[model samples]
Target: MKKRFDIYKEHYKALISLGLPIVIGQIGVIVLGFADTLMIGHHSTAELGAASFVNNVFTLAIIFSTGFSYGLTPIVGAMYGTKLYTFAGQALRNSLVANTLVALLLTVCMGILYWNIENLGQPEELLPLIKPYYLVLLASLVFVMLFNGFKQFTDGITDTKTAMWILLNGNVMNIIGNYILIYGKFGFPELGLLGAGISTLFSRVAMVVVFVIIFLRSIRFRRYKVGFFRLGLSRTVFGRLNGLGWPVAFQMGMETASFSLSAIMIGWLGTIALASHQVMLAISQLTFMMYYGMGAAVAVRVSNFSGQHDTLNVRRSAFAGFHLMVALGVVLSSIVFLLRDYLGGWFTESPEVATTVTSLIFPFLVYQFGDGLQIAFANALRGISDVKLMMLIAFIAYFVISLPTGYFCGFIMDWGVQGVWMAFPFGLTSAGLMLFARFNYMTKNR
Candidate 1:
């Protein structure tokens, strides 16, 4: 027991060392989103609702692009473990190409969505706010993708602090920009939702620019920089990236679509419901980002272990990350639950929206376990490069089961937004269980 305990302790320490920076970075992102929602919410509930709709749509694309970039992490992580620095750098170059292509494709898709935004059944008044925000976010997509490529490369090398600092700085800039532009403070024109979008775009571009400069000049990256400049992109590398990337992208995209599409359903309820949904979602990101940060650490560790053919350590690392997430979930859910009444008011003054947000807390609590489970094991699978199955699993969990259940409860049973929220527990739990089972089975057999 003592020996086992020591092993677990070691794994926990390792995970925390890698995960803390990432968590801080992700928290910075959540803060930025929270700032956007709050500033826009107070500007006008209508603008808040429009932000929700447009942000959800853009989030799906962003997540897809991020997933595409993730393919680089496991590849580079494994290579770095073997001290194949040049090979890893070459992979990063290929990742940049693949990620850029995905960004362009997503841009086109977002444009199509923007063109048909009116048909989505949102309140007609919200369209004006949505269009400009959507376009700004669409323009920022390429920069986000570029930053993801650099982020994954850094994360794969187990130097997460670089991205962490950069993200936090960018987030701070975004909030400052939001304050100035949202309220016309500091000699800035009040642009409302458009201001929030513009701030986001500027921050994203700045992050990418900073990452590029660091990669080119930083002594820490000197070795990788040599390989980066020397290694040219090749068809084989591109194909490999695409092969690994697309499945992960589709899986993540489908998972997000579950929520984004549900935004449309919530819109059907009215602007107040949509605003409430946005507030709840912003709060929920507090939990999700923490889990994802730890999960990302798991991917880095597990991939490194896999490269060394240390299956036992890989399993241990993944579980260690999950343990952290479970604890985090408990803490976050308890806080959110205790403050549920006051939470909604932080974003908007609408009593109706606050009440709706309070009503959704239970569903949020119910999904925390599932969310932690799926995130941990999904990263484990990514580390092992077993991404193909994720697409099918996501499809079944999010689309076949969750969406239909949400529709049944929200529409047919007339349970409204709270009923729609109920679908999350089902879908996330199902995906989590399946992913955990799959990871166990694969590791055992190996």
Candidate 2:
């Protein structure tokens, strides 16, 4: 055990370096969301609640596409590590194609969903605000996909700072946009919730455009520039990417779907429950994104080692990330537990909502470790491009297990919002253990 710990020591530093920037970037995104929720919540609770519902529906599409683009990182990482720069470029092109296809697919689905959201038994008053908001958000999905593809490409090549900067700029833009649009400042139409949606859509579009400009103008990206527009879809490359990408996408999609679908269950509890659910969701994203930051670093390091055919280093990198994440989880959970009382009041003025959010704190803390574990090993699997197995495992853990558990607890067991959250621990722990085992098995075989 001591020797193993020592082996991982060096890798831990690498993971930290890679992860810290991502964590920071993730915080920027959270800040953007916080600004929106805070600014909008103050105007009227109804608009705030409407944003929660519409965003919940959009979460599935956002998470799914993000997962889908995640397929690119490992391939790009391996190719870059092996000094196959052109191949890396080609793989990135393939990723773009795959991401674009998934984006279009999601666009069609969201279009359909926009048409049906009114029938979801939502409060009649909120639907008027939700309808236009959902449409504007739908328009941003393609830009999100485009940004994610660039992000995955850069992350795979161990250049996360670009994404960090891009996200920070976008967050700032989003906040400003929200302030102006939500407030109807500078003679602009006071479109209320619709303005917030428009601002978000604008910011998302800007993020993708900036990424494209940076990739084209940056000297570093120019070195490997395969004619971005000239790269036609290659059947072999697409098949290979899909083989690795789809499973990972589904795995992540299932996990997100669990929480997202639970939002609906919370809706059935009442408006207060749904509102509280949104607050918890926002808080939970902070931890999830932080862990993903570290996990992504682990993925890059693992891919680096894999390119050299060093199984030992690959395993070491994964565990190194896991150890770091455990520490982070402990610290974060402690903070959340301690701040449960004040935390809710800090976000909104409603005592009822605050109290409900406080009730869900323990459940949130319980799953942080499992969340960190799964993210580490799952990214480890991605580093080695052994994603198909992980995807299947995620399906069982996230979909077959987690969602049903939450639904049963929330409805059949009458646990309300609290019951819905308990399912997270069971599903996340199961996923972490299974992915850990799979990572071990793969490296041991190698």
Task: Work out the TM-score per prediction.
Answer: 0.99, 0.96
lDDT of 1 by residue, 133-162 (tens): 888889999999999999999999999999
Q: Sum up the clashes in candidate 1.
A: 0
Q: Can you tell me which runs of candidate 2 are displaced by over 4 Å?
A: 1-5, 227-232
User: How many pairs of residues in model 2 come into backbone collision?
Assistant: 0
Worst 10 residues of 2 by lDDT: 223-232
Winner by TM-score: 1
Model 2 lDDT on a 0 to 1 scale: 0.86
Q: What TM-score does candidate 2 reach?
A: 0.96
Candidate 1 deviant stretches above 4 angstroms: 1-3
Give all candidates' CA lDDT scores: 0.92, 0.86
**lDDT tens digits, residues 1-446, model 2?**
98966777788778888888899999998888778888877767778778888888888889878888887887788888889887777777788878888899999988987788867778777888889999899888889998998999899889989999989989999899889889889989888889899999998899989988888889998756763445566787788778887888888888888888888777777777877888888888878888989988998888888988988889888888999999988888888888898876766788888898899998898899889989999999989998888768888898888888998888899888999998999999999999999989888856
- Per model, state how many residue pairs clash: 0, 0
